[model samples]
Target: MTLPTSDTRVETTVTEPGQRLLTVDGLTVSVGGLTLLDGVGLTIDAGETLGLIGETGSGKSLTSRAIIGLLPTAMDVTGSIVWRGQELLAASPAQRRRLRGTEISMIFQDPMSSLNPTMRIGRQVGEVLRRRGVPSVEVQRRVIEMLEHVGIPDPERRIGNYPHEFSGGMRQRAMIAMAMIAGPSLVLADEPTTALDVTVQARVLEMLRQVRAEQGSAMLFVSHDLRVISHVADRVSVMYAGSIMEQGPTVEVLRRPAHPYTKALVASVPAVRTRTAIADPLPGAPATPADRPTGCPFRTRCALAHDRCVEERPVLRIVGTDRLAACHVAEEVSR
Candidate 1:
């Protein structure tokens, strides 16, 4: 699908009357009786970026998939996904189809797979424009312009190239261009730069931030890298065992984490200039949803674990101004 050239400058503010763009409330996903996401909730306001950060099995990607209605049919999903005050989970397939691309778009983790292998890069991008009823000639012109906007050199010449023709970094940039070309109200980026080199990753992150800002788009940026989240997101949610352990402003949560799991994650990030020895890695493997502990899922790996943590699950509680943490000892941890 290709976006129309004339529609390139269309900027839509998607906030509800309360200024909330999207809200996931009490969302749960279970596959074959094994839960993948358990009562996860988060929100993104108009033109704001919310970072979903956690280790590989923490249900970060699952949460994103649920929002976009991309989860497998076999998965048993329960909960509400509201976008602009509309319940998305209850929306018909046709409605979701219409909402996708024009209202919401996703930059998938793997650019190679997300893009059509047989289609030329230009056509694939133009397809989005075409879906919006763009004329063929205009699609081609805007495709090249978008390619150039993403920093692809000599886009007019490379427009005919296939996905394999572009380098890894370029492919990622192309994915970004495709996602943002339509000026979606919300953009969900699922670890879009995971496969790129650090230099390329930085560039892609910068491009994502710049394009989203220019388009006035709200973004849900999913990543396992706290460093990346710190650079791109205004606020962040830390997930563990399919639940949000802590959430607050990115700077506050990164600097003074109120949850034990969040603290461990911060400690694990390597310091660039300091000569300090490597910190002790978090103990124990991440728990699968099916095998989660009786009470706090992170209790098994947390040093602050006590009888209370084993007997009762901690609900998200106010820990500071605009901060929430699901830890029994959040006060002690923050101190």
Candidate 2:
């Protein structure tokens, strides 16, 4: 396998003290004897956004779920989820519950499922405050403020509306307001822009960017859109099947990806046509997690796959400064 040469190495600076917010270390997940995640590691620093991009079924959503303790009871997790020096994965139920809304929050992918149709929009957002024993009056005040903060114009008139009463964009805004009501320090957004019109998609992306900047929360923005990730991501991680294929600063990784799967994903973006005057959508769908080939899950689709690639699995290792890639043909890919 192609490993980083000594000359290619560059020293990395550790961020300022007390800035590390969330960490997922060697996180492994299995369901019904099927390994869904194979030792994924991610760290989100305070006030930075990490965009995780991949095709569907690449375990992006599962990584989000695993962090929030929302993974199904049928699955087993073997790893540590540390937050501010505490091991959250092993925290007691009450401790986990306490940390959930006050310290960490998740804006789920689907607004329809995330919201309560029976609950008024204002009440839904206020639930977080109420759970913390804040007075009802304060909850109402904070919920309305959040509604206005999330770009729901004239929030006072719409506070009583239910989920079904609002348009898709409005509903999504409300969901954002709810997740962020308590002013948590970390947010996980899973496909926050899916199914929205282009204009609304841009608006929602702007809203998320605003909240993260104003609140200074570390964020993990998960999606399939490299173009969208390019807009708001400080760092980018390209995932394949169930493992990270390549990761680095957004600009560097996007411009010179060292993994074939990552290159294929970037080339498949429709917007790439406008810039490069050509597009090559990745052929074939992703391999199922349960049936991935032994050597490398992506070898079947990689253009440069060789005999060694098909016979031995490649592990993620340093390829450049602040960069890691899992591919036997890393040198060929970089060129």
Candidate 3:
């Protein structure tokens, strides 16, 4: 994603009532020789879902880690991550920890490890309450309510079961309850529905929506599945090789995508019962951070690449009303 120029950030996007609860500005993440994220920026509003979609190895998950301060020690991140007007990256570790799992919670992809094998689900969920100094009676009640909220069949029984005792889908529900029990304002859901039966996936997603609706929590949902992202996200940001290629309202960007990469990605989703279907996947694989093209990281894979694409890096300039893309040829591509 092309980052905001220093001057651009000075002119903050016009803030409506509760325009943003979280804003990441010109964030860059590097691990020794590799630049995992290059100037990625995004905003998640209160009570909104922002779908962050990208292909595998595109740094989608990495971006999530950087937000929650879960990246490995080797990676150095520089940028401003503001939550409720307080800078997260700039905050002390103790301060960040205080905010995490209470003000901001994240549902990690793998539920097995996320939930301790030895701990019962109820205890894990109540741990947050304990840390917050809630009374034991209230913690138990909240844990049971959370279990039921995620649609576990037998909430009371399942609450006492260890992680290993629960099935995959059930384990996921437990994880969701744990992440959400604190009633965080922002929830980072990193592919929480992947690899589940279609029916179960729908249920989980619906549960996320309900959680947001009932609690008024904002969400940043990361996924490679554009289809799934489109279903849950109000706004969408498409990423490629650790940068946002295009971003706008979900329907607008998907219907009239400005970037060549976004167009290819939308076309590539496998649909049901389509005859003579052909997915025009982008021509070349995304480059590693170290070897990105001089002018455009996506230039080598773009069908509309020109000499200038290889000589002058394209910034993510606004092309449409309320939309941004990092492609010199977006205007012509739309034509």
Candidate 4:
């Protein structure tokens, strides 16, 4: 199938609220001559949830790490990561350290691994406040309050327990408490519910939303599950091979995906009410960043790929009122 590309520009009508909190422009990450991320860019508004969804090895977690300056020194990153109008990439290590946990925080995928086994739950959560010169008494009080707020029963007693003492759900909740205890302007949640059961996952997601609402924090929620993204994200960015395939408001992107990769993802989401299975799950494993195709990274697996897709890489362009897609046939797919 040969799908024609659209040349006419369409103005985006989606009005994003709040001030611009982050702008990642032309972000490229490389390690040992392998480009992990290729010119990836996105904007996050204050108090907005930008869901980053992709399969494993799509560089979703890497993007978050780059933003937070968590990447190892060996990896070379060339990009502009602007946080609240300041270029984070250019910021000093000490400056970044101060910004981390205070202006920005992250909730890792596995709480068990993220939390120090030797440290007490209260001390871990209170560490952020303690570092900022908050009185020991106030730090203890806030730690207990945050623990209780995250649905941990008997905060006073449980605060003294170690990571092994808390249940999986409770451990995840403790991680959430630690992330939000500082009341950061930005929060990066990398699959926070990955290890939890469905019931616990639901509660954790709800708690995350509640905490975000209370703190008014902009969040970068990364996950491979579209269903999970649909519930928690206000906007969605679909990534493949370290490149953004599509991005827009969550509702529109989920309901009417403009990119073939996104369509495949939406198709793969099993329906809950009817319990319908995905008739055609996407074929082939996702492309590796090091071995990406010259033109379109997804062209090998794309059904509608034509000569144009094989010869010319398509950059993200306006496909709908608010959507941007990188596929040459994005408009055709949307129609």
How many clashes in each candidate? 10, 0, 3, 0
Worst 10 residues of 4 by lDDT: 1-10
What is the TM-score of candidate 1?
Answer: 0.93
Please give, for residues 125-204, the per-residue lDDT of candidate 2 as tens digits. 88877876778876777777777766687888888999899888788878877777766678888887775778768877
Predicted structure 4: clash tally: 0
Candidate 3 per-residue lDDT, tens place, 1-335, comes to 11112221111123343457899988999987788899999998887999999888888888888888888888889989998889998899998888778878888888887889988889997787788777787778778877776778788788788989988888887788778787777889998887477887887888788767756778999998877887899999999888988989998888888998888887786551132466655667778887877888888888789999989888888998889999998898666
Q: Alpha-carbon error at 30 in model 1, in Å? A: 0.4
The CA lDDT at 102 in model 3 is 80
Kindly state the number of residue pairs that clash in model 1: 10
Q: Pick the candidate with the highest lDDT.
A: 4
RMSD of 1: 2.9
Tell me how many residue pairs clash in candidate 2: 0
Clashing pairs in 3: 1-243, 1-244, 295-313
Itemize residue pairs with steric clashes in candidate 2: none
Q: Which is the better candidate, 3 or 4, if ranked by TM-score?
A: 4
Candidate 4 residue runs with Cα over 4 Å from true position:
1-17, 272-275
Per-model TM against the reference: 0.93, 0.91, 0.90, 0.91
* Error at 190, model 1, angstroms: 1.0
In terms of lDDT, model 2 sits at 0.81
Candidate 1 lDDT tens digits, 84-176: 889999999888987777688888888988889999899887776787677788778878888887778899999989999998778988888
